[model samples]
Target: MSEIQTVPESRRFLSALGPGLAGALSVTLIHEGARRVLSHPPRMDVLGKRSLKKGLRWFGVRPSHGRRLHRQALVGDIISNSLFYALVALGRPRRPYLRGVLLGTLAGVGAVLLPPFLGLGRSPRRAKRSTALLTVAWYLLGGLSAARATRTV
Candidate 1:
């Protein structure tokens, strides 16, 4: 009989990092590209900027302004999204699509519902139904990307 092998938590997280980053970058590329082409793309960047500024203030640091603020927000978004997607590493290696769906759904719902409570702004749903839905889909895409990238690593 063959014994199943289990990876250490730290190793799992480390192994997941590259895939997580790939997922995050994919989402950003898609989102930014859509923003350029679509007349009404999801403006999640606004929320990200607001959230980052608020976080910095809470930490007694001043936030940047103009293009610099936007750049900072983009970086922050990638790092955060990577960490969130990395949670999938805790699950079994098989059925990555299922794991992706679950993680993506959770993040999607939170993106639409949690902003107001967090003082970031109103929910994305309040702006436009299509945009809100697209926002969710974007995260879903990220999840799937991370899941697929895991196979290569």
Candidate 2:
């Protein structure tokens, strides 16, 4: 009789790490792009205000005046997508569009849930929404980066 071998869950989880890291890198790139787009002084101020309002609305809470919740959202976005990618890499089934959507949803939910639970600042709805948006954005960015890198080689 022949013996069969099975892959361990930890090994599968480790395999997923690269994709998760890739997702984070993609997000960082998009964030840099957004920042560049809003760099001009007048545009910067306008975007700042809009981002804060959006972040507040996203989490179903009011933002402190002059607070940069948008930036925090960007951070949360990276964290959430990275986690999803890591999960997927860990031998989880892939669903392409659905995966991105699920990741975004989780990111939004976590953003709203974590802060208050940890005795930090109030959960910002706008930031949650922004995190969700960033997840989708990172997915697109990751695909594009992969495609471009493949072409260059």
Q: Please name the candidate that would achieve the greatest TM-score relative to the true structure.
A: 1
Q: Evaluate candidate 1 by giving its C-alpha RMSD to the native, one decimal.
A: 1.9
lDDT (10s digit) by residue, model 2, range 1-153: 998897787876665555666656664666566657643211222333455566677899886553366566555555655656565343234343445445545543554455556444445433555644453444555544432322222
Measured over all alpha carbons after superposition, the RMSD of each candidate to the real structure, in angstroms, is: 1.9, 9.3
Give residue 68's error in model 2 in angstroms: 18
lDDT of 2 at 119: 46
What lDDT, from 0 to 1, does candidate 1 have?
A: 0.87
- Put down candidate 1 lDDT per residue, 29-132, tens digits, no spaces: 88888988998888778889999999999999999999999999999989999998887655778877788878887888889889999998888899889988
Q: Which residue runs does candidate 2 get wrong by more than 4 Å?
A: 39-84, 92-97, 112-153
**123: Cα error in model 1, Å:** 1.6
Model 2 Cα shift for residue 48 (angstroms): 17
Deviating ranges (above 4 Å) for candidate 1:
1-6
Q: In candidate 2, residue 34 scores what lDDT?
A: 64
